[model samples]
Target: MTRITDTRDGPAEGARPGALPVAGLLLAAGGGRRLGGRPKALLGHLGRPLVEFAAGVLRDGGCVPRYVVLGARAADVRNRAELPGCVLVDNPGWADGMGSSLRAGLAALAATDAPAVLVTLVDQPRVGAAAVARLLAAHRAGAGLAAAAYGGERGHPVLFAREHWEGVALSAVGDRGARAYLRAHAGAVALVECGDVAAPDDVDTPEDLRLLD
Candidate 1:
């Protein structure tokens, strides 16, 4: 069973008055098999674990009661990462892939009052607070599904309204993680251009670690 540790209650304190309460869900459970068994969440960046930086991006982007899904070395991440005010979700099936972490995150957030959730990858360090704010703005502007776009192509930090949660969770299998759902409803997704303010390059291989530099 997944253990969802709720660190806070009530509507999102980070959201502005009369604004839609949106929760930020960070998927940081990858066991970097391509990086010699190291967990991505525990990867060092900016003098702290990568998970810490990613979680901070969510908080700074104005998301309250944030949720982080941990799987690979869950205990180690909890011990090493300083994620105050964020709900830590344990996803035992994380080895299964991103979908498991997504499902775990959505399940934990199901108990919240947030009308939407902004899903971000822990590996995407370059997708900063600006990109997140853009997606949140799209949601506030009446878009049900919104995603960051770079050079006209859609990318991460996707915002999903409550109505799409069930479908996304159902289609979420393996590493797909809403990819299929987003594709199925492409016409409705609001693509917010974030190329100027941020980048979407993800940290994966040894060569990609340079992105963190």
Candidate 2:
């Protein structure tokens, strides 16, 4: 496996010795390079920062030991966002792409013995808590990998078991993020239909921002 720099430093909380604590890992470090370099975490979403909204989705969905990875105007995000209990991890290589943020989130979860991380993106406001809840159900049922599928197409808020975190991290390059890893193990991925509960629209470009309006 390729060795990346340590993107995390502290221990959040230890999971029970026999239990697999499921954590909420929000990848909010995107700089929104295509969106006029605005940090997605600080983008307005229904009168609040998108990071807070994204984290709420995870929290309300029943994920414990929540952690948010931040970069690209990290200090500004901290000062403005209302992230009360989330562990804020800074990914120095965030400019490189989403891979770093994903890695940072998993690294932080690993420190606490969290067997799995329910991952979400800050720009994806349409993926609601129901979608995440479905994935959580699959994880608790012993699915090593799970993702919300919209019209049979895999989308964000994926779940990764502890055993596969390293491989997923190693394969997470550029903005692809776990795609190649999941592709290679496609047969093992549990797909949950989320179209009925949520829309997988993302706030990538200016037009996508209107979803929050």
> Best candidate, lDDT-wise?
1
Q: Supply the TM-score for candidate 1.
A: 0.95
Model 1 alpha-carbon miss at residue 157, Å: 0.9
User: Worst 10-residue stretch by lDDT in candidate 2?
Assistant: 1-10
- For each candidate, what is the lDDT? 0.90, 0.84
Scored against the true structure, residue 57 in model 2 reaches a CA lDDT of: 91
Note each model's CA RMSD in angstroms.
Answer: 1.6, 4.0
List model 2 lDDT by residue over 1-213, tens digit each. Answer: 222222234543333556666889899898888899999999998898889999889878878778888888988888898876577888888888988788887876776767788899888888888998899899888898999999999988899988899999999999889999999999999999999999888888988888885
* Alpha carbon deviation, residue 28, candidate 2 (Å): 0.5
Count residue pairs with overlapping backbones in model 2: 0
Give me the runs in candidate 1 sitting further than 4 Å from their true place: 9-20
Per residue, candidate 1 scores C-alpha lDDT tens digits across 1-213 of 998776666745566776656899999999998988889999999989999999999998878669999999999998888988889999999999999999999988888788999999999889889898888889889999999999999999899999999999999999999999999999999999999999989888988899884
Q: After TM-score superposition, what is the CA distance of residue 97 in candidate 2 from its true location, in Å?
A: 0.3
User: Candidate 1, after superposition: displacement of residue 81 in Å?
Assistant: 0.6
